[model samples]
Target: MTADSEISEQPIEPATDVRPVDSEVVLARGHLHPAILLLRLLDAMRQSVVTVVAGLALGLPWLLAIAAGMFLLQLGYALARYLTLEYRLTATELRVREGLLHRQERRIPLDRIQDLGFESTILRRALGLTVVLVETASGSGVEARLDALSRSHADHLREVLLEARREIVAAQQAEDDAITGPGTADASAADNSTATASTAADEPEWLVHRSTSKELFLRGLTDLRLSAFVVTGFALFEMADYLGFLTQMSGVARGVRDWFAQFDPVVLGLLLLVLLLVVISFGVITGTVGNLVQFHGFQLTLRGSVLHRRFGLLTTRQKTLPRDRIQRVTIEQPWLRRATGYGVVKADSAGGSRAQGEDTAGGWDVVVPLTRLENAFALLPALLPGLEREHLPWQRGSRRLVMRTTIVGVLIGLAGAAALWSTAGSLALLALLTIPIWALLGILAFRNLAYALGDRFLALQHGIVGRYIAYLPTAKIQSVVVRQSPVEQLLGLAELTVHVAGGSPTRLPDLTIENALELRGELARIAAIAAARDWQTRANATATRPPADRVGESQLDPAAPPAGDRRPWTEPRGDGPAADEDHDRPGGAPPDSSRPL
Candidate 1:
């Protein structure tokens, strides 16, 4: 056939569903909104409240004007920043460019992107904007936060970025297979392309689950932080009085103090008891109400490989965690929640941040703040997909676990009683009551201690007043430790700890020494296998790239040097007819050692 006819006869391949990789594409640009500037201003003020209050305390008219000027300057700067903020997307990277005085460009590879979350404060949400937080597995607690994007745009961007990551992974797997050998028939590129096409097509996404207002309210009520907030609120109230904001209230407080000073011993005791009761009541009310506001309409949504959580009362927080990025899953059930058959499910990821208190804002993101135990169990498969769930054979602690715990609790109780003996005399004997209570606690804790080994996960369950179940992927485990104390040595019991990338290690104590050691070996073997597979996969991917010069196919050598020699692949060698053929082949020249061999 003539060249023109041959060209026309060759069928043209159809275009792919995915976009071509081009750095010039502007996926979305962030436009500054007045509400965003206002939110930023408020956040600044909240962060520097003490400085602002001090400036106000100077009581100078000029200071007030200066503060106003400063606020305006900050607002103007925020506006400028928002105007400069823009992001671009390519097949492999998400590029963010922003700066006023100095130019900055951030290019995050899609492969490194561990999470893509969309958060919105009440003001932003009202304005139809979302704050997109991009977390990479860089081992840095910091995340790239893009503010003032429309909610729809943010969601779309998140979807595109995640799909791009999946595409990259699929391409890499194909390359790896090409190098190593053919992959399974099911995992072929044609199948993958077809699946990608269907997914990219107009497939309606479904809502996985959402938290009810009642469930969130119950979560807030069960929050242990509620107890601590009582003290914080009292301190704030005292600060307000000291600042002269509540002159009338301060007078009442002084009057109460005077009344208390004049009370007899028995009356003073009764007043103290009443004060404690009042404080407890106040704490309960404040804590529960605060939690209710913070998690008013918490919702969990799933779209393919990503799980998104949207929550908040004042500052609506949205967290997106990739199923593969999750390092561990913890299910916590306090006595109260357990009694009501409710539990909280939390997930820890490699790129997650540590938060204080209940960690509602941290990396310990709550998958389900409050749900029925059975429902929570059912929800796990959805949250962490691709993993098989099985009923593992649990290894219960020995009876010695109970005895050891009782002895330790008794010692602690005795120490406390002895410390109080000189001050309270016979009344100190009342402290002895803690012994039985602690013993019962120890017994309950021992009873709850159990662990099971899954094919790819380690499940640990423990706790007394509260029940904790931690599921750790064997592949993510950094190390396993088996420790024994002197007492434990005599009893042949040990503690087993499984450490992951970040966060506290999950521990199962009072295991038999034999069992703990056996577990350690098993974990080590699994870790080794996982590491080897990753290494081989990476090498295969690297080796599968097409040669730069197609004319010199002979130059693409395939054999490795003998074990004793450490020569490079391109080094000249006498390796039989293959080497001679490479040297004499048409359109090929001798290997160049000067050029990096």
Candidate 2:
């Protein structure tokens, strides 16, 4: 045996580090609790009911039989899956093995893990069970799940996995130090390493923000999803009407029909309008109650590098996001909330779906559900420390934005007018009257359109009835594009899109061509610098790393990138004719994000 292996067989002194190396440990096997079978059965019942209702609507007896058979099949499958499901975590990987006849297994590396979110329904909570969703940096949905784990086991697994990741990162750092020489690393790398070490050695910076019952209720009251509520009420009324007619037992419906038949067309229209108002009122109330339920007891806690969110009344949820994984931050205000000075702050990271049934899960994690504008601003620096001082003052877009938006609105109004003319005869000209209203909306949209840039970040604000302001570090941007349409070209206007990791591109429309290109070039340089800094860090880190770790490979792609290419940021293409070169033209600009509209 080798000297190291022989020495490992001996008991270490107490002064030596007792932490186990990742490769030397084997995680204990994990089994899904029997409760999973029960949960699956309940889910199957819900699906069965939906299937039966849909099938019954078709007036087909075979479909009912099929639905029953499907439910039974699903029940059996759930039982089988519960019996076969198994999970284990080793030093370097998480292993999940399931399936009976078709046997499936997945081995996810610890380094590949991006985040983990925990959830518990009312039923599951009562049973002391939780579901853990495992996500990777692939930007898709949850990659793996451990359903129906005991609450304690779930917590333990989370701690173990997170701790494993930290150990691996430390190992990588150590290897990098050996290769790059201690204290001689790149300036940026040294700063990051120092910050990480200091954070670990220092007292935990933990802050918890809780929403009071009064505030949460007010939040629901102000949500005001009027249109959604109207649609819901209408659907319920239609269903009730149809059921009454089908049973031939709806006196209310018959009376309504008779009353409607007695009224003149104009009077009937007025009554319908009144009825719409009543439905909308009911919808507003229902929406308010829904909002209350979803955000009740909302709490956000930041401990060290991870953020924790817990909320909901009927179904409690807990989500965990590492600050380092966050790619973008957004602040949003709907008209109702804006009037109340409330804003919803959200953070988008590389992976994981938001908690189930959390209405604010619009491809991001809601950091602050309903906070005052100032509070939202206060929370932003903690969530996005890199852009604290880098964001530029917001600048309004060009007047071309107003013209384009107004034109689009006018086209929509024309379509509405034609439809109304066909249906209401003499009332068709009313469509032209609506043009002013549409134009007002267009003006609102134009007023909200703005963009900002900083030394290391880019931000855009837009939306009409609701506003969304999104910001991301320039380094996190994946690509930049500037495009011009024929109409826009004539107006000397162009649109720019900054594509960031893990979220939709932030688009800034209607800027002068000079501004757009200038912005694009600056963004390209910033992104290139960030990319290069990260690349060099990786190169230094992996220089002494063992081949087994494959630290040089990308998180999503295991292959090493091509070498010896010139750095895009360092090129001298910033001067002269090359600067004016349009990417759409051959031998012009390099393939940027620009494309003809």
Candidate 3:
């Protein structure tokens, strides 16, 4: 109202900086396109089908009435999604406004956004529509999603989000204007800031990274994870047979059932043995074939915040996961890779849902394209550039002990095999072979297990079958544990487990006592830096604390977290924007993605 108001009326000057000051911001894409409505319609239909199927499975009484009810309900809901959902991207916020009679709205300020992921199912891809997932500040429980927009629109939206976030950060840092030297901190900060902003805009710069559709297809074709998924699918059916969820609907299952139904008591024992063998065989085939399918011709691209990967022949898919949503990054190579000087890169993204009780998400959205070991450093800034040091290395003591323990494990496994064969009979053939595979796997585990450090970066690479490389800031670590089992105790061995929010521990086994504690302390220090969210040095800080009642109402009570919860918060490293605006959210407010900052 004073001098500032009088100046505001003046004509604008062309300034170099286009950034914003507040940590909170409005979005860039606002109009709800028809395609987006179509996606909501599709989702409503799918949910309706699931509900109906569930009812039938539970034996709903009055079949015809139930069927009729389901049809009407589904149709009604789908129609509602089409008419009511309004996905919007504003200048400073991503807002979801919807309602039939009573409208509702939820907004996410760009600065608090952690990630964005694009997903395209076969149908959605055909429709040229994709989903944009947004990960928010709290890192757990609630998320916002833009259900349906064309692939190009989704990409553009990602860019807008990035730009907004950067503007906010720039404004916040306007005061001190602290600029670190170009040598170290500069590179790391630039990487994170760039990743955070470019995820959306990065795609446009693809003239430099343009991949042919064929390349994307081929990349998907030989993806080890897909192959692993296929193989594991078979195993899951076996597990389901044991626990009774999903089952093989093939002739073999039918034959087995018929035989069991018609068999005499004398044949039951034989039948049981056959079933057990089938399970073991399935597991073996799954493990082997999955390796073939998943990593056949893997290739990955790292340009800006987008990490693009494609692998699969029959049901091909290509994905571009923005760096901001990269909750955890991992690099893994079998000892085979050590020989080739090549490794696999897999990232933990926000889109996939976790199978309850499992260490990793059952259907995690992963990008597996073969990559170079050295590139690990190059990609560090984008994924997590706030690591304590310039470089992180493998825990030497742990690696050595683990390698030695592998050799010893072979000796013990052989002893066990001999005893087991004497008692269990010929089935022990597989167990006997385990002695060698274990030794080999152990050797590979030790040889392949490595952690590379880069300025403000920590990268973890391990595993043979299910290899992974995780990128995380020291700040992301919630806790560190050092434990030893009796066998390890006798051998002066211990295990170090660093717990990040909502992820399985990176277990480094058979480490010396001194190394285990040392590693823990080192990680903790890094975490301290990451958690250092001091705002004092900033020109300004803009934060959006949702209405208190709404925040409390929407959040998962921290007191009642998922069981065996690792992090005190236990929020995994995030969700994308797809679920950001939840006027139609099932519960009060969905959990903000549990993710790295």
Give the best candidate by lDDT. 2
The segments of candidate 1 whose C-alpha lies over 4 angstroms from its true place after superposition are 1-35, 41-57, 60-73, 76-80, 135-143, 152-177, 184-206, 224-275, 353-359, 362-364, 385-389, 410-437, 541-597
Model 2, global lDDT: 0.63
Candidate 3: worst 10 consecutive residues by lDDT? 545-554
Model 1 Cα lDDT, one tens digit per residue, 1-597: 132343345444232223344645655545544467778888767655655676779766666566667777787788778878778777777888889989899988665565566667778878898877786644443357787788878778877876776676566545445544664332243233223222321233335557887887787667654335567657655654564443446787767556656878798657555666667667667767877777668777654344667777777877655554567888788877866768898888664655213354432467887877655655665544322223345556666776776666667768878999999887877777777776787677776776777666677778776777777767777788899987789789899888877657888798888988998999988876555443333233332211111111122121321111212123322232224223321112222111211
Task: Rate residue 435 of model 1 by lDDT.
Answer: 72
> Where does model 3 exceed 4 Å of error?
1-61, 88-90, 101-103, 113-118, 125-128, 135-142, 150-328, 334-342, 349-368, 371-475, 533-540, 543-597
Candidate 2 regions off by >4 Å?
1-24, 49-68, 137-141, 183-205, 225-258, 261-274, 354-364, 406-439, 542-597
lDDT of 2 by residue, 495-591 (tens): 9988866566778888888899999998987776566555444444432111111111122110211111111222322111333322111111211
Q: How high a TM-score does candidate 3 get?
A: 0.55
> What Cα-based lDDT does every candidate model obtain?
0.61, 0.63, 0.48
Is 1 or 2 the stronger prediction by lDDT?
A: 2
| Local lDDT at 1 for model 3 | 19
Candidate 1 lDDT score at position 4: 32
Best by TM-score: 2
